[model samples]
Target: MVKLNKKYLKPLKNFYVIGLITFVIWMLFFDAHSWLLHNDLNKDIEALEDEKKYYKNEMKKDKKAIRELSTDEGVEKVARETYYMKKHDEEIYIIEYEDSLLKSKKDE
Candidate 1:
């Protein structure tokens, strides 16, 4: 019985040490505040990834616009609408929607 007890003591002490270390690590690094911080970081990463995807899509649209604007017809269309300029003897018409003209009316 004495020899058996001695044989188990070393293993028991090792397990105790390991358990204590694990507890300390869990308390310091895996507690509620740590978990909340990790979750926040994950959410922030997801939001940034969404922002990146949005910007990538926007970049694609802008690139398409740039390519189109390289053509003469696209340039003329943008200039005519944006600057309200037309060729000689060309008449420009302004169209306004009654619904959009009043912001409060549209909300109701």
Candidate 2:
């Protein structure tokens, strides 16, 4: 009887240890909260990367405008296009978008 008990106890102990290790691993790496946090981190990383790209593009456009405005012609061109500034004899016309008209209709 003693020999039979000893034979079974070793395998049972080993199985318990293996099961505990697997459970610990699952809780750390594959559990619901762990998965949620991992997914959130991925989305945060993607959003930050998109923000970085947007800022890079804005900086590039700003730098190009700066370089152009360092000369007389670029500043004049930007002012005319953006602010409707013109030479003494020139005229300006402003065009409004249809969305603003629709928005006013909805509000009333």
Candidate 3:
């Protein structure tokens, strides 16, 4: 059975080879912080960074809009469009196009 033993145990004959294999296995699976975990954490960090950038950009846009809306004319425009506010005795009629009505029916 020497031939069978030699075939299975040939790599263990070299101390450096055995040490390298052990180190690789330990780093990949047995360590507290494995290579796979590090890779996944890195991806998570990248995704969080992208989300941070998106939120920063959105915050900047919101700040600009807030600054604009602080003015009287900007407030009036937003009030008229969003709340449909009108002066006393003013009449407001909402008109929807045929295509928009068809689109709304299709959506429903």
Q: How many residue pairs clash in each candidate?
A: 0, 0, 0
**Candidate achieving higher TM-score, 1 or 2:** 1
Writing each residue's lDDT as its tens digit, candidate 3 over 1-108 gives 999999989889999999999999999987979999999999999999999999999999999989979999999888888899988999888889999999999999
- Reference-based TM-score, model 3: 0.79
Quality of model 1 by C-alpha lDDT: 0.88
The digit string of per-residue lDDT tens for model 1 on 1-108 reads 999899887665797878997887887688876766787999999999999999999999999999989999999999898999899989999787876779757788
Task: Using TM-score, rank the candidates from best to worst.
Answer: 3, 1, 2
Q: Give lDDT tens digits, candidate 2, residues 81-103.
A: 88889899978987779998899
Task: State which candidate has the highest lDDT.
Answer: 3
TM-score of every model versus the real structure? 0.62, 0.52, 0.79
Residue pairs of candidate 3 with colliding backbone atoms: none
True-vs-predicted CA distance for residue 92, candidate 1, Å: 0.9
Give lDDT per model, in order. Answer: 0.88, 0.88, 0.93
Model 1 bad stretches (over 4 Å): 1-34, 103-108
